[model samples]
Target chain A: MEHTQEEIRKHVKIYISVFAALAALTVITVAVSYLDLPLAGAIALALIIATVKASLVAAFFMHLISEKQIIFWILLLTFAFFLVLLFIPAMTS
Target chain B: MSDMIRYISKPHPVTGVTNAKLGIWCFLASEVMLFGALFSAYILLRTGATEWPVGADLLNVPLATVNTLILIASSVTIVMSWASLAMKDLSRFRIYMGLTILLACAFLVVKGFEYGAKFEHHHFPNSSTFYAIYYTLTGLHGLHIVGGIVVNLYLLFPGSAMWQTEPERFLGRIECAGLYWHFVDLVWIFLFPVLYLL
Candidate 1:
């Protein structure tokens, strides 16, 4: 699909905003590592921040939010499989 | 009969995406599984261990933090390069794409230094379970980066000629490359915090 010049310019603004958010989140994650939290708490906080950062990149940079229905289906299946793989260790343990 | 390709310049009527777009996503789906399995392995190892080392203690967090920003910046540049094509500015596309490639190279150089330092300190993959997994995961990711650089270099130079003949198809190719590059960056988003910070 072709994007108009104006549309791309609009998207560019969002890209920059995402970049800033990502940069800030990166710093925050590192800073959180220095805190005196328990190991489990630290892991949760860091991963929560990281998941937010990953979502921004996927939604905006990868343009997955507006992507086609079929692609979403593919990703949905992939996510399902991902969940299954994640659960394997838990089940075995 | 002429040997020509279809679905390159335009979206397929059924799928609503060009062939390249669909193909790349499917490829990326497989990639997710590949990395996801490794991530699963990581969880298993960590949870089962009685004594796990702190990543920040053994690793260079500052260097990794810098690498994270570099990858994030490269992701933006890659997308901008695709946008530049949509704006019908080939030169702008080249500039952004070139910046993306250079930033990626800078990341590799920094990683090389990190790896070099590790070797100097005798932190080989066999040093411990930590070093082994660190090298395996990051080393595989590094290979992916090398693969991206090769594709991006082609698109930036010789492959760009297609832009003149088939602009839409060329744009599609850029979009695919951007998707791949962004996936690599996304992997790092997780790898950074999971490996270094936590």
Candidate 2:
């Protein structure tokens, strides 16, 4: 809360860069969808791009990168739970 | 007693509501799983069907393409709204949030049109095994967009003293809302191709 002006400016610069990267990633997603990649390749590419975009939103736009460590663990555990749900059913089938 | 007191004494930088944002985030994670199950089911069913309707034949790709862009744009505006709040620009924050809500409404309108068109063409989910799952998957995502609009409108009002007295905390709530929104957008991103373009 008591950040100096210089510190604030530095954060702003980084945030802008992240937003720009996300925009570029959006363009890439649309472009890649046009290619004739295998189904698995396409799905993998889409997911990878999505992960990069989400990380930018979470880290810079949402400010999670600067947040407390407890919050990080909460986020990580949540994702872990999500993986369990996604894959657990595959075993039975 | 002392540990609880100490925990209460340490306010989060973004919110004083202790675990409010964290709680919201955790809830949204569960939502991801809920949608994930439906999507995975879609993959399995479509794979097994004898005459799977190729997405292009079953969907109006141009219209869905517009809807996709609208959702992705809303994701950007919602994040910008939170950033404006963090920068202490209340007016700008309100404007951004309003735009996000409008964009969300636009998405719903387009979705309604798409559904209407589908019904006109006798494209009900029951029409085929694929349409059944397609409608169910995208329909769930559509409901989420409507939910997001309601949440944003609730936060947009000037009479909400919580936003006035604790700006950072209010912003954190918006951030939590944004997370839910981005997840919804991501689901559509996956669904668009699976149901329309592909």
Candidate 3:
């Protein structure tokens, strides 16, 4: 379906909100780093935070949530490639 | 208006142009694994160091931090470029995409300076395995940045009217490229502490 001009404007609003949230998350993650948390804890917290931020960007900004099944299959193939990467290192290590 | 849409709904998939995005994304996924292993190496080496190079003592964190922020800013610009295209503003699309490319070049220039400064201080990869992985990972990432800049330039030139005409197809390309760029930034986010801050 063709997007109405109003719908496009709404998307821009959502885009701005996602951008603001991502920026805030970056700042908060940096701030949290200064708390002297355990190394594992700090890293875990940062990864969790980054994952959430990336997800928002992916789902909305990248529109992955509305993508075609073929696109999803392509992404899955990429994920499978990542698994191969893990195996190479696992063997080498 | 609704009747206009009923006559022609979906456009045909533009052959390899559609595949181009998936191709880029696949290559990037492989890159993540490559960098992931190197980062894991960094972790192992960091723990093994008898005296971990005090971050403040060995490298210039301030410079690296600026580069990090530069990359993050570029990420936003890249997305904005894609957004402009989606809004069917080709001129705005060109402007933002060009700015993104410039910022990417700036990122590399800063990195080049960092490498030069390190070499001047005899901070070669042989300094330790830590430095080894450090240079290797960042160096590889640097090359990827160069590759990305070239891709963006290719997309911007007048010759790519196919991309210009059907901006949705180009949107997919930009989205894929942005993912790689953000991953580059994400790698740096982790690298900052491991290399400069911690």
By lDDT, the best candidate is 1
**Cα distance off (Å), candidate 1, residue B191:** 0.4
For candidate 2, give the docking quality class from DockQ. acceptable
Ranking by TM-score: 1, 2, 3
**True lDDT of residue A28, candidate 1:** 93
The TM-scores of all predictions, comma-separated, are 0.98, 0.81, 0.76
Worst 10 residues of 1 chain A by lDDT: A1-10
lDDT of 1 by residue, B1-198 (tens): 212757876888999988789999999999999999999998888888887888889889999999999999999999999999999999999999999999999999999999999999999999988888899899989999999999999999999999999888899999999999999999999998888877
Task: Name the lDDT value of residue B52 in candidate 2.
Answer: 66
What is candidate 2's lDDT per residue for A1-93, written digit by digit as tens?
233545655766775676567667766776776786886787688778777777766676556777767667776886787666666556545
User: Can you write out model 3's per-residue Cα lDDT over B109-188, one digit (the tens) per residue?
Assistant: 99889899989989998987767877887888888789889888987885358564655556666667677776776666
Question: Model 2 residue B160 lDDT?
Answer: 44
Going through the candidates in order, state the TM-score of chain A alone for each one. 0.96, 0.88, 0.85
Tell me what TM-score chain A of model 2 achieves.
0.88
Residue B105 miss distance in model 2 (angstroms): 0.9
Choose 1 or 2, whichever is better by lDDT.
1
Q: Look at candidate 2 and tell me the lDDT of residue B57.
A: 69
Off by over 4 Å in 2: A1-24, B1-17
